[model samples]
Target: MFRGNKDEVFVRQALEQADYACGRWIASQRHFDVDPTSLLEPLAKAAVVTAVAIYVETARLSQLEVQRALAIETVAQARALIDRLHPLAFGGGWYGGRALR
Candidate 1:
């Protein structure tokens, strides 16, 4: 089993945040006022950004995943993307890796 410490806290937080974004997105979907396509970038960005947070936490991942998540051009979009992430990324001991068997 893998034990994640403070060094990896950011990744965990990212994953949790990603989760929250998904939930919120789902909630928004239930509404007639908002169009789902309007949220495409934010939701996708949240997932990707959170994935990068997970990569940062573990310092382990595929080049493609890293490229997709961490290699961002703007800090502002990254920050906004991070904000929309699910809070659980900071909680629960997820390593962006698989559950330890």
Candidate 2:
């Protein structure tokens, strides 16, 4: 139970970070001369999937197997998005071999 709760919390935090990163990316698009249309779909999809995972985790806490799997999958997805968007949004350094900065 504690592990499940912890996983849920982690997933929630990851999703929140992804959301923030997406917002930053959108805001910085003009400065970066990036077409918002090119990235909006993935961002929107991530948001929707994150929301679904959150809802599922919150609504089905008792279902450990499903909750754990969904949490893992959602975190993976969020992390991947974050990894892709971090450099583009924050402009610190290269990420995943792409020189976003």
Candidate 3:
């Protein structure tokens, strides 16, 4: 779970960085008055997988490996986030891609 203020700030920073990387607008501009939690749900899911993947890769450098729990959690989180994502999130010109319609 997020640790509170400091962590929440970091989370916002991370989301801003990701927006920059993806050529997307700032969450405040695109998402407007929407709660940050709605924006973060998908990001948290991706962050979990990325974190575990990096850990696994780094562990391989030392001949170690990730535990099964991490893999299970990743899959479950992915499913939950995917289910929550609207089709619009993946489609249209909104994301700098061609519109599905």
Candidate 4:
């Protein structure tokens, strides 16, 4: 949904892993390989793999911050503009007020 090539690698890896996992689950579903009840082992392995990937990837994502810097910069620029128009003046008689320096 994000507008860039950023998710390509992630999506590709997810598809590959999903396919592999489905194959493994299917393989253990017949009177051929290990006991069909052993599907939980591979399922558990897939869960662990997905969980580790999520942990590591989310940690990395937290480190990406150029967009945050740009947002802060935009707010600073807006503050400067507002300051230019609203200089506070005080401590002058009815004749005039001192222009804020």
Candidate 5:
């Protein structure tokens, strides 16, 4: 889990939103044929949520340089953990690389 109160709140909000969207999307897709790969979508969204939480929390840092560095590092770590748990989650690409900038 991550540190910081605001960060936790942000992550919770993101996760709730992701859940809502995923539920809606899945329901909408029920009419169509299902594929095994479709199950990975939620995992990918979770990775993105983790990265955004890190970015949001790190931005509160006092120093600009430190904030930027920490954001990238934390996001990378989150992505790595997600990728390790579900290798197919990100499709072999780092998530949220552009969001940090």
Candidate 6:
């Protein structure tokens, strides 16, 4: 139970960090009209994914039966918001030069 609580705290912190990154990306986009392919987008996405993964893993390790739909929805929403806002700004890849995968 103590470990579960600790993991929950960590997950919350990660999610907060992810939210901050998303806010930064949104500010950059709104103020500077930055491209979605910029570093901010990937950084925000990475943060968001890391947070969601942490939550999912914590729940698994804790033997807590949580619905994964929420996690999936969170990721989907973040991706859509990040990509939809700057549809025309996707000329370059995420890393700027070439695709990572």
The numbered model that scores best in lDDT is: 1
What clash pairs does model 4 have? none
The global C-alpha lDDT for each of the candidates, from Candidate 1 onward, is 0.47, 0.45, 0.40, 0.39, 0.42, 0.43
Question: Lowest-scoring 10 consecutive residues by lDDT in candidate 6?
Answer: 61-70
| Model 1 score (lDDT) | 0.47
Alpha-carbon RMSD to native, per candidate: 11.5, 14.8, 16.4, 25.8, 13.4, 13.8
Candidate 1: RMSD over Cα atoms?
Answer: 11.5
Worst 10 residues of 1 by lDDT: 92-101
List model 1 lDDT by residue over 1-101, tens digit each: 66759657976675566565565664343332335334344554555555565644554444555554555444444444444332323433333534211
- Worst ten in a row by lDDT for model 5: 60-69
Candidate 4, 76: how far from true, in Å?
53
TM-score of each: 0.27, 0.26, 0.26, 0.22, 0.23, 0.26
Candidate 5, superposed: residue stretches over 4 Å from native: 1-40, 61-101
Predicted candidate 3 versus true structure: per-residue lDDT over 1-101, tens digit per residue: 75669976987687567745452332223332344334333444444444444444543322122232133333344444333332323343334643122
Report model 4's TM-score to 2 decimal places.
0.22
Candidate ordering by lDDT (highest first): 1, 2, 6, 5, 3, 4
Candidate 6, 1-101: lDDT as tens digits: 35658877986785566564565653344432444343334444454445344444643322121222223333345555445322223335554532112
Question: Clash pairs of candidate 5?
Answer: none
Candidate number with greatest TM-score: 1
